[model samples]
Target: MNPPEPAHTPQPDVVAAMRGDLADWRQWLARVIVLAYAAAAGLSVVAFSKLCDLAQQGFASVLAFNPWTPLVWTSACTAGVVWLTRRFAPAAAGSGIPQVMATLDPAVPAEARRAFVSLRLSVMKAVLTAGSLLGGLASGREGPSVQIAAGVMQHARRWLPPHPGISEHGLLVAGGAAGIAAAFNAPLAGVMFAIEELASRLEQRSSGLIIAAIVLSGLMGVSFFGNATYFGTIEVPTLRYSMWWPALLLVLATGGLGGVFARLLHASITGQGDRLGRWRAAHPVAFAAACGLAAGAIGIASHGASFGSGYGYTRGLLQGHVDVPLLYVTLRVVATWLAVWSGVPGGIFAPCLAIGAGVGHDVAVLCGAQADASALIALGMAAFLAAVTQAPMTSFIIVMEMVGGHAMVLSLMAAALGASLVSRWIARPLYAALAQAIIARGRLAPAVAAPSR
Candidate 1:
């Protein structure tokens, strides 16, 4: 039988070549899966933005018909949303940043992380955030977007190639950064946020994955929202050293306020030492209604300027197209605090920017820079965000991209750094503190219920 063609044995070289080809194919497949995930994340964020817009429009129509409608409508909406969230997805409450942070912690249990980032919680987050906006709550979608996108990424972990290198922590970072990039159409800011706020090292193997995800999602945002700057470009003059004083003033004022806001927010959300926190914990739904009533009153007093995420108001202030009262900043801050403390799902990002913009305007007037308030406003935005997040690099980069204020890059960096330092003196890192609290709560939850059983 001609020795059966040497028993059809393949050479060592041939076998090795075949194995190499298979490895290459697997790598490419993994890449494709990551790309697909990035695209899905972008699409989800765009859809969420559209829902928020529609909700805001409906609320605007209601306000047009009767400015006082939010009094009852907001209270009812808050009560319903609070009840639904507590019943079905208690993890979906607040801005969602802490939940995302908690998931990245290695010490947190897999089960707790899974519970925090379930698809069900993500869906509820999107719907209830829209509900909050529809009721004219001072909430933003940006923070919730991070958690939503992370949830999508976490869910996709089951489909990934079973490789030790592809850790859940890396996926969470990529997903959350992609959310920020897609939400604001700022890709670089997304990368910086991953490094600074999310505490991602961008390990060699996963670095390419993180960047690719950001690019794809950001491109999707550009495709839908166009390549224009988020807040539109301004005609800022060349920065002179003499004009730096206003930035310093804003650093102190905005930073101080931002620190206070972070402290109060953390206390309220965690129910630490504040009396209001105890009340909210005891009767969440009823307390939400009361908070809503207060928000409604603030909105009425501010002539609707304090409603929604305050995006339009901030843009108006930046463009000098709208005029608000001296107490606009105060009202916006209080409104944001109440809306968040009510136990609804929303973000403080846009509301904080609006508050910062108002502060910028006041500073500009004081410093006699009324002729060009855009730069000061941009500085205030960066400063307050940095102070609140304790992430100066990410804050400045995001502000720069949002306003297209490259000319003021140095000033933005300075303001952000200065404000972050000042805020550090007043409060702990807001998201990290909240994240640790989440982990502690998760650890205690079973024990707390075990006694009941």
Candidate 2:
């Protein structure tokens, strides 16, 4: 009892000890979060591979049909997607990136805030993405995959025990990075992407968690998918000093083109969704049928070059087996742009890859540099992704991991950095800017602002 005297006795050591314990707990929590992100990332990879297999099987089935049958199938699928979008969730249309940006933007209002984790959006996105794949749209599944993974993680937060001061935005970034890692089987790229593209801020503390999550996700993906490269093994080429000038030129041109494409895509798809909504409301089945018919016609004319994720075409470009001329690349580019702009549910990521490969192929042939087509294709990929997403480091690292080996690192770095700079000069970051526009237009209400860190 006598010892209980002096309630205000000095205890600097106790405070210091408490602070040390808190720091240790924070580190432990950070590790756990990273582990969770890795698991999610691994699942994302499995999901992407399954989707790819399904898409491939679907394409094979359609190809087995008579030429006319493909046309009919294309029309039917496109029409069904349009009807479903009009009926169920119009927000599910397009690349899904813009919607994601809108969802993440802090300026969005509370009541008007669309549920990022809504099961409805998930189901609709899956359905629309499958439809786009089947309907011969030139899109990828990565964007939808990103949305699905983000939504899943958002919903998962409810069950997670509350952490004293954890940020949901960080979780969302982790999920998105995992999604990309899973999709491409590239963990490092995903980590960089989380910081450069998704996270508005770049700092060691914030990046530490995201990086851990990305690595974990990538590891998980490899565990499930057998640690194979996304595009198989790539043959690295010898670099020559003479080729630098041509590579630089290719980077600049492709980067500028990517910026233009980004601008056009945003303008065409954003407010235009409402117009399609009105059209569908007035003539649902017929409008759907017309869209399907147009898709079929394009597919047939392009001899199926315009279908799916453009993987076949990308492969062809990589292998130096593109059967068509440069004009075909242009056609495919326009087709992809229009297909997505017209409200097809898919992603531009893969299509951009295809476009980049085509551009690289054409450039390589024109320059008469007997460089390995695959190397050129890889460079093109980095440049195009950098230009479109304005995430050069992410694009460069992702391509390197996807392609494997270090022979082409210098080329990739130069091209990606150049392309990113060129694109940035031409346009604002595509998704972030789009999110801001949506907020400005009152389409989405602002949310509680989170410090980017």
Candidate 3:
């Protein structure tokens, strides 16, 4: 007792070593978290896809007998679902990319956190998106996949170590990126999307976390879905000198059409608080039913081509098995517009690619270069998506991955850059502008939220 206790001390060398070890451990933990997110998101999206596919089959079954019956049934169901979503889980409404983009902003990360990234909202999104598919809406599930993954990872924060360096924004971006990687099995595209579409500033995201997350999520996808290009493979050889003419024509055609589509969609959603917009906001359920009716009418006219996500039609076009009519592209575009304007929980990625394929087919016929249909279709997909998102890099990379090769990189690049330039004439960017509006709404009305997930 009389002996003075030696003062506790740490050797500088030993302390430095400890700090280094701690940093490494933190990084290791971050990787583990990302992997966990990847596995969960991949498995969940796969299951969701299966269920939605089954629902689409049911819609097809209904359509086989009488289109009118299905039309009325779908409209009623659409109205009911939209009502429920608005009254209860408002967050599960439209393509969720905008919500994720809004919340990831460094300036207002906390504004939409509780509303958009909650576990409860994720569950609602899953259920509602499936319901929308069952209603015969022209919708895709990928957008909901992004929201679910982000929400899951954000909620899993409780399990992470209580380190001072832990960052919520980093986790959100990683989760969203992982979701896209798993959804399309495109890892690099996922990272670019996070940077190009989600975060407004580099400091808001953790690049290390995004890479780790994408690898894990993409691996899970490769394991479950196999390593096939999402749109199936294309055997593109060296382009003939004559192929350039059709390719160039396709670039302008797709770019102009996509730009107009993007501008129209933007105007419909954010119509400067005009009469139509105000009426839509005031009577959302009625308007959603009407939109569903219009989509159903388009599907009837297209002989069922306008139903579901249009994935099967597009894939068939790629494999040279489906001979789609020229009018199908215009009808499908109308269907997509109706469904999107309805604010249903779905994505436009699959539909846009399908429409692009249709456009390519027509352009090929007009240019008498139908022999290279697949290449033209691929180019159109890249071009239209680039114009829509104003993300040429992400669009080109995703298209390349979807096609499973680099043979068309140069061509895809040409289409993407050209389309992006044309799109600038219409608007700044679709996703970025929507994201800004969402952030403003989140702060003004915390209870109001609308997205796919």
The candidate scoring highest on lDDT is 1
lDDT at residue 317 of model 3 (Cα atoms) = 80
Better of 2 and 3 by lDDT: 3
Instruction: Give the TM-score comparing model 2 with the true structure, all chains together.
Output: 0.84
Against the reference, the lDDT scores of all candidates come to 0.86, 0.70, 0.78
Better of 1 and 3 by TM-score: 1
| TM match of model 3 to true structure | 0.89
Error of 1 at 347 (Å): 0.4
TM-score per model over all chains: 0.92, 0.84, 0.89
**In candidate 2, how many Å is residue 180 off?**
0.7
- Once fitted onto the true fold, the runs of candidate 2 whose alpha carbons sit more than 4 angstroms away are 1-41, 109-114, 202-207, 271-291, 321-326, 446-453
Q: Which 10 consecutive residues of model 3 have the lowest summed lDDT? A: 444-453
Give candidate 3's whole-model lDDT: 0.78
Per-residue lDDT for 1-453 in model 3, tens only? 699989998657988888886767766686576567657766666666677788888787777768676579778768877998888888777888877777766555364575777667877888888888888888888778788778877876776766624478777776777777777888888788777777644443456655676667667778878888877778785699998888888878877888888888877866568886887899999998988888887877777888888888888887778988549888988888888888778878778878888888788778877788888888888888888778898888888998875888888988999988987887768877777777556542455454321
lDDT of 2 by residue, 296-402 (tens): 67767877776677777777666666665436667677777756755667787888887787778777777886465678778998899888878788888877877
lDDT (tens digit, per residue) of candidate 1 on 168-285: 8887888898889898889898888889888647778878877888778888889999999989987786677868788788899988999998998888888875677778788999
Q: Of 1 and 2, which scores higher on TM-score?
A: 1
Model 1, which residues run further than 4 Å from truth? 1-22, 443-453
Q: Model 1 reaches what TM-score against the true structure?
A: 0.92
lDDT of 1: 0.86
Instruction: Give the Cα error of residue 2 in candidate 2, in Å.
Output: 49
